[model samples]
Target: MATLDIKLKKANKVYKEGELVKGVICVDAGRSEIAHQGITLIMDGSVNLQLSAKSVGLFEAFYSSLKPLQLINYSLDIAKPGKLPSGRTEIPFEVPLKPKGNKELYETYHGVFVNIQYSLKAEMKRPLLAKDLQKSCEFIVEYSNKDAKEKALSKPVQFTISPETLTNVKEKQNVPKFKVKGKLETAVLCITKPLKGELVVEQCDTPIKSIEIQLVRVETCGCAEGYAKDATEIQNIQIADGNVCRGIPIPIFMIFPRLFTCPTLSTNNFKVDFEINIVIVFQDNHLVTENFPIKLTRF
Candidate 1:
């Protein structure tokens, strides 16, 4: 039996646009030499989108029209009609990281309905009556650091959530009075770092049961005919439980999960956005939420 594998030079398997993806293909044949017709290496990067369950019927036509947006496609012939020795053999390779014609390379993201991925596949064709060997591995792509200055100059966003400023309240008279103030360290967040902030409950007529921070992903997919948009919770973290103290600051900290998030992106075919929701649950089983739209960057 024979085995094949791919190993990237970078242990982290991360690269930016315009860099060279350096790697090697390893082949191991037990006790006998292996014969192959040809060996090829292929690299691909694409964005895949899917409609949520609720949007299935509404966008039947759009769903059928949905196709993977191929950003990069490159192939290399590493060996021609090669033969492997009895032991392990390694073949070095280097492929340029570039996007297709006029298209741009987006950061690799893994979402419920939208996904951007980059991978390398290697194939070894065998002669008659022998099974071929193949192997594949994924790599991460991040945006270049060109907006460092802009991110450094970003200002913190201060917000206040009170009953008077709340929206969509039909029975305002029945609602309890409350005032909460907070500031997001910065609206422009670095995806590789933790989100930082703090909040305080100035005053409240009713007792607080819990306070939580909910991270949501808003995805939109569609064409000129129509589009389907949905918001899904990626994670929920409770900062306070059975809250009793008032006038004390509560720190807000959250780490952006890899694969589940990327720099906020927008394209003609789809959009990937993120938001933070501050939820306050009252002891009486009532809840009030404050939402904040946030921008993510590689800087």
Candidate 2:
């Protein structure tokens, strides 16, 4: 017999731009377990296409061909994932996002290798009980480079906001309020220990390495939606060993575009969901996105 299930390493049912998702895909193989080949782990997501171009040379009149193209997909494959005996295994993984335009591969004749918009599906191909147990997840590849700007913000301060979703609407048409608003706060706790994460790059042609525990800040972030939002800010934050630079997470709070709505409809109350956005900056410049939700509400 065969079975399949998804076990997320963190409470990560959602994600933000440039944020890394952590977890394991667990698969159990029942009778007919023998002749069982190892397992494969796959990760993928569908994304919206975003392309931009610049004219550095000719083509000022014919239509510039020097354009930029980026794909909104991140995934990895574990050839022989970890096994848990009895034909069951939980494979761990880490995927880095090259958010829109962070960098792209191009050609002179093809313009930009634009990724229009495609669905992403990362799964495992296993043989067990005629049913397949796999770990699959989805994420967004935003057109925002806001994550890098806040890198200078120092830390040790654990920062996050409440209310994951922020929504407003017009009264008569049940339309979500176009310009909703909310507040977020940061905290400085006396940490009895430190948070850690690993960076793996096998293409380096060298051995993997790790650094000591020297950090500056602990940041948290989330998102919001509306035609417009409140001029947001963070305060009262504290840190342990390092300084709290901006005292908050990057993009502070991002905007998720409206996926469903009719211009004729209006309402003031709706759910604006945001999972906690977190970052732990290590002395070596290793950024770790923590598990937290700064979900908020505006009524």
Candidate 3:
């Protein structure tokens, strides 16, 4: 293989925080002749926010809540891609970055800090070489514009994992206890189809019904020994009604998808872990969160 090196006009340059930049990547091949060369550029950033709520009941002190927005990945881009020949070749690239969110949203607005950046990566072959070589470089970005908005919302939202908890009296009940005239394989809660509907609930009732609680998930991960069975269940606030029972309550949604159970957690290993999608249920058109505790303990 021959020797090779790359050169850039300006190793790095900063644009107005939200501005754009135009540049090219150059390759200089020495004794070695290049077979094929490709270039790629990437850019990214982050944003955060905090929220809170307070409400009261008939005559009692209500509830208060707070939440924080995690790091949000602004964006990732591949500016240019091309194959290069021997000798010196240049591949140009341009990137347009967006300004960070505003400062007013914070109880105390901390001037938003916009971080700009760029990266260059290339792969080339060696002259009559044994193996090809690759290299990369990254540059910084500066803020260009600051168009901050007061992130406002009047709706309630929560992100969480759901759980599946169907007490089957596993194994120990040796005999088929249910003396029903139907098929022995029939599941009491056969979710042939995911019941979809609105989830907006007004309030929860005293002794909720079986259909009141929505099953957020029935997920399973793999175990080291092999595929046995690993699952978790969760619950959340929702609307429910059955017979004379009514009000905002917990609802359980049964998700029995065609591929509900995976053969492996991930094809790479034979661990007992499998991927089970968490199905959601809606009450009065509003989606609910799996916010309760439901874990299984084996002897």
Candidate 4:
């Protein structure tokens, strides 16, 4: 059987915008010499919207409600085909992966309800009655730059949660009345950096049992669906198996590992968010929980 393989020249598969994708298209003519049209290379990026809606009935058919938006669509004519020898031939090519418009390219993401994907295709066109031979490969795109880092540093820190300022949303069953205040060094932080903060339990209706600090990542599917999961936890931080009096402050710090977390990102279909979960357990089995959102950026 005949074969066509598209191999990226560089070993690195990860790329950013505005970079050139260099590769070679190798064609292995199976048995006899072949004649064809020109070779075409197409590169594009798109965001596919996926929805997790329940089926109407057991026998009802389902269709996708989301549509894919193209971020980049470019084609290159690698060569005007002539005649190829019976053996193997290689053609080198390079094409810019930049998007067409001023809109920024989104980072590659694979979620339950959304996916941002990119692919490179090599097509070997043949004459009439013969099928066109095609091959494709996928690559990753990350958004990173010096300017984004500078902006992240200069961005004001808005990480703070005060029980006194707690709104009507804090009402929950078996939750004790308490006033806790805390602040972080910065609102925007790199994944490599440690999240530093201080928590003070000013007053409480009951004795404090334990304190737990948790790192949570919230992945929302557009404005319709939202999911929250704990990425990490600092267990028994303070007042463990003990009680804390009023007017006591405890230091809080945790380094967000890159393994289970990603930089905060948002698109029209989905988003990822990082936050700090402050859970204060009372001796009476009551709970006081507060959460503060923090922005995470890539290094």
Pick by lDDT: which candidate is best?
A: 1
Clashing pairs in 4: 157-187
* lDDT to native, each model: 0.90, 0.31, 0.31, 0.69
How big is the positional error of residue 183 in model 4, measured in Å on the Cα after superposition? 10
For model 2, the superposed segments whose C-alpha errors exceed 4 Å read: 31-38, 45-70, 81-84, 100-122, 126-135, 140-299
Per-residue alpha-carbon lDDT of candidate 4 for residues 1-299, written as tens digits (9 for 90 to 100): 56788999768677788888888999998778888898899998987754444422321232233457789899999879777788888999888878878766776665444567888999989989888889998877776684253345735443334455545445543455677766677778886688776767676777877887777665554333333222334222442346765666677778765435556876655576777777777787666567778887876
Each prediction's TM-score versus the true structure: 0.94, 0.32, 0.27, 0.60
Lowest-scoring 10 consecutive residues by lDDT in candidate 4? 55-64
Stretches of candidate 4 off by over 4 Å are 54-66, 146-187, 191-262, 267-270, 275-292
Model 4 / residue 249 / CA error / Å: 16
lDDT, candidate 2, 1-299, per-residue tens: 55655555446244444545566665565643433334554443321211223322222332332222234444455544333456776656555544445533111110121122222343545456534345444432222334222221123233222122212212323221121121233221111121222221112111212211222212111112212111111221212234322223222322322221001111131112223233333344433333333222110
Give the per-residue lDDT digits (tens) of candidate 3, residues 212-233.
4333333221223222222332
Q: If the candidates were sorted by their TM-score against the true structure, best first, what order would they fall in? A: 1, 4, 2, 3
| Deviation of model 2 at 73, angstroms | 3.4
Q: Model 1, residue 81: what's the lDDT? A: 99
